[model samples]
Target: MSEINPSQITFARVRRRLTKAQLAKELGVTSRSIQNYETGSSAPDSETLAKMAKLLNFPQQFFCIEESMPVIGEHAASFRSLSKMSDAMKNCALSAGAIAFHINDWIEERFNLPQADLPDLSDLPPEEAAATLRRMWGLGSAPIPNMIQLLESKGIRVFSLAEEAREVDAFCTWHGSKPFVFLNTMKSAERSRFDAAHELGHLVRDVYSMRHGETRGIEMEREADAFAGAFLMPSESVVANKPPAFTIKYLLKLKHYWGVSLAALAYRFNALGQVTEWGYRNLCIEIAKAGYRTNEPEPMEREVSQLLNKVLDALQAQKVGRAEIARGLCISVDEINALTFKLTRLSVVPADSSIDLVSRRSPGLRLV
Candidate 1:
């Protein structure tokens, strides 16, 4: 350990949000001395370090001691927001970080790896394009069990985008050959699942296009939607079940069957000549009037993403105590309680247990 220099004292003082004059008033020293201290023209004595620590409420060692810090990077708060996130919330979006970090690492590792020659989808017919993807991925069946997990295990990054990206429900970006898909999490699981399928469509079909997120031509969106519908529900199954006109009841039945929005299946019905274009439009208007667009009429099914499940398993595998994890990850005390609360629902910790844990503060948290 070394003596406290003026810079260290001044840095800590500013971080504590104390001004030079204010610190001087508290320390009973002149403002000039504080300024000189910050400029490294002067230093605080050991006794003064104690006083500063008492004021700042940070470990005295925080001044010069170094420790390994976790990588807390930011992601787009939303597709619309320009500002990046702060270093905080790395723990909150643990699954996102874990998968994204691995995906990014894989790209860096394979930067020089030759991209496997993919089909030139630009010239292929839409059916051929879809078929090409089907062959490439070997998705030989009708109904995908859980779409999110399916894409993630294939090296695609899927995040449920925030509510603001409702209009723009999903997107795809490629780091080399790997696709990063963001599904709007704020949406229903049905929609999120479809969005994942749709983004996969974009990744498979539109990989050659230089423009990524900002490229919003009708052609691209249409192709992706087609891909989503066919990929999730498949073409022949839909065609096999065609009706003259799709009613609200019919659409509702399939919503549970395929986990897709009513409007999406309605369009499919119209496209397959199950209903006239006018009938399809009227059905949508009727559904909107009934508030089916805003809320599920029946109880919606819940699906915990595989990504979140993996994180839970990882924690349990490490045998980390809840409180230790909370503090180590810089999360709220309540977060640990809430996570452990499920398993420890009936298990109660005494009031003293809380005090015992809190008393053992992080080294950075101690003032002295």
Candidate 2:
């Protein structure tokens, strides 16, 4: 009904790392036209707008929003690293493990967030540890729907941290009592969801596992993963009567709700004593052969995180847009959009390495 904001479209496309030249060719426009649109001196016709939306895989309305925010949080430090790193490697690294983020000191710098003076979670048994966390956050017995939002709600400062550290296999690590969960942003919503839960394992279970700079151990990772499994799918609710035959269709149906890898679900079933070890192994081979692992998985956080929804809802309710929030913080709009709203409300170290200021509420707020 209204004209699109060309600048917003260009920003979103570039944030996705789609080049102007790439989109121009796909949309049958000259690169110079794309440039003009990005600078906001000119606009696209309806015909061009349809093509742009199709090529970018975005709704045309997405470009009509006045303010555009970076989907992931970015800092000057992160942007500098991105310029130096290969995108392909970044993709692989994020999809891989915890080893990737260390390439640019994201871990080191993120651990330095002002509120990260982690309380000691050591010497407590698993049950006691989880309970202490619940008590601290005032959580009920019900599972946390969104791991990222849940962590952010509790002031844990969850971030995607999928910067180009290509060598990493999918793993999470804690820095100075601050926990970071890196999900390969490129992975399907399914894989990303499980990765989020897996990282949640590291956060909730490993509060006390650190000593003298030791990283998360394999056994510790496993126990946290188990917690994530039970927490996410709720083994009691999902476990079938008469062991509803484990077929590919059955697994797909399970994945629809669980957002866990078939392999992980396969393992969970074995743990529940629903399937034999041999059946589990065979199922794994079958699922793998069927191209389940390589195919992108769904994201659980989109469905689960009440934290994220609440933040967006609260902001929408307040009519507090991203630009106003960023202007209030005197930081990039990208930071506010990338992380959950609670993280912003909490005092965080500002992105400016050049300026070190206290993290507190600003006295005056509202966009000019």
Candidate 3:
């Protein structure tokens, strides 16, 4: 029989946001014993192991699986607000990334997903890079109808951030050649779209290629925000359709056109010099007074992942449901659901639906 992998214990603990001391207390063991078990110097007894599985909400087989887990360190990911996130929050997010790696691999084995087509724009300024990428993708200053679909179409793996990691908006990281973006679906729809575009900025600008945590610096955050503004609301489009005045109502009317928040649209115009400094300050004051900062007016519906939706639908056609996937991966179904919450909506595939369950190339799932 295979021995339990010690690292899996560490992963489960981190995923549950529990410290070694906490877990040891829950399992009725000493902290040193937990440390020893995690370091492979000792193994948890059967009773202790069962308690661990129960406490951590992981399947017993998860501790025995020999598969290697993906590593995502603090230096590797480009987080939006790194200074505000605690180590526990960051570890919880990274743990989700690790689980996503396994789920992505499982999906890829059954379907030919789109390959990465993002460019490296580290040499250019944020706005110029956004323009260049738009031209490269042939998106010619048009409003992106669906940011999630656009990202998935370009081979970026999109996932939802669990509520435990909600303190930070979103983050992106590169696992080998595959780029993954995790969004906090709890945010407003417009904010979520901006978050997706902001992560794309980090990816294309080579923020993850930095030497260390420099990717989380304030300047880098500004660059990513600038990139997101320019990418989502192109200068040409915003200029041609500039509102009559800088009134909050006028700005609110145009925000839906670009699928961004009213404040974002106001800031964009101000950046372009369309609104004077005083005018911009007044706009900000009005936005805050109207509570637009906290609550978006006329919010749109949250965007779901097209790639994951299609993959899950196709997988279900072959009798592979959430429970089966969880069992195969030695993970609990709740963990899987948490990773894909609001991003994947499981639907029944009609008997007459034209889906090729045996073939890997199922129409829209082919490589680009």
Candidate 4:
């Protein structure tokens, strides 16, 4: 067997959301030993390796495999709440992203997934960029019925954050040629849609610059928010449908049509100069009074990944189960679940089950 990379041990433990001391306690070792192991100053013996593998729910072979490409970086991820998040939380999210990169690679090798079709809009303004992407995707000014499905069809891989990291809103990163967006699904669907579009902005506009060390700033975040507004509710469509005067009731009604949060709609109206600053401030105050700041009214259904569902279904047809995939990746099934968006359904075929069972259980992909 190949020698283990110390970094792999750290990644495995961190991916499990374990502190060094916590993992050390579980492994019947001192925290210093765990630290040494992770820092390459010492190596664990066979017995220690076995304990680690069992404790971390990863195969010992996982530690021996060569390190994966460095997919996560400080500049790689465009965080929605970078200032509010802690280092541990950030590392946890980035580790999840690295796992996603591996999972995507595994899936791509077996399936004919959609190639990314986004155009370069780095130089354009956010609204123009959003408009251009919609035009390229042939979306026009129509409201997207399902933002997750739309992103999947366009070859943007989307994943849900682990429930533990509820502080993060959403983030996106580019891994090689693919764009990956991770959403915090605990939020309202409307908020998640906006987040999806916001991350989409980062992936399309800031990805290349991020690699060049132009890290995401306040300006970039504002640009992304603008993109999300224009993408979700086009100015032309808003102008055509909006009421003469912006009211909380009118904004609430419009939120349903645009599938955006009421607050986002109000902000968009203000940005478009349809509502005066005073009106916008009053609308915000009213929206807060109605408790739409944290929880909005008339929440839309949460969007899920269509591409992952199809891929998993296809694998099920071939007698490949989630457990098998997890084993192949040397990770736990729960870890796989964390890396996918609401991947709860597993098509299991018993030893005596007929081949017809596969066909009966698998649903056809819903291509938009």
In order of appearance, the predictions have TM-scores of: 0.56, 0.49, 0.93, 0.90
**RMSD to native, candidate 3:** 3.2
Q: Candidate 2: deviation at residue 79, Å?
A: 22
User: How does residue 296 of candidate 1 score in lDDT?
Assistant: 57
Give the 10-residue window scoring lowest on summed lDDT in candidate 3: 348-357
Predicted candidate 4 versus true structure: per-residue lDDT over 334-354, tens digit per residue? 767776646335445433422
TM-score (C-alpha) between model 2 and the true structure:
0.49
lDDT of 1 by residue, 226-334 (tens): 8777777656777776654478887787767767878778877676566877887899899899997877566345444454344334334444344433443333334
lDDT of 4: 0.82
Q: If both were scored by lDDT, which would come out higher, candidate 3 or candidate 4?
A: 3
**Number of backbone collisions per candidate:** 5, 17, 0, 0
User: How well is each residue in 260-304 modelled by candidate 3, as lDDT tens digits?
Assistant: 999899999988888899999999999999999999999987888
Local distance difference test, each candidate: 0.53, 0.51, 0.85, 0.82
- Sorted on lDDT, best first, the list reads 3, 4, 1, 2
Give Cα distance to truth, residue 291, candidate 2, Å.
0.1
Any runs in candidate 4 off by more than 4 Å, and if so which? 343-366
Worst 10 residues of 2 by lDDT: 72-81
Candidate 2 lDDT, tens digit per residue, 1-368?
47667766755465345678887887888999889888887889988887876666445776776654322221101111233456545433332222222211322231232233234544554435555655565655444545555554444444443343323334444533445555444455555566666555555545444323344444665566565566556555556422478776677667656566666777778877888888888888887887777873442434333433444344444454545444433234444433332223433333333322223232221111
Alpha-carbon deviation at 288 in model 4, angstroms: 1.2
**Distance from true location, Cα of 279 in model 3, Å:** 1.0
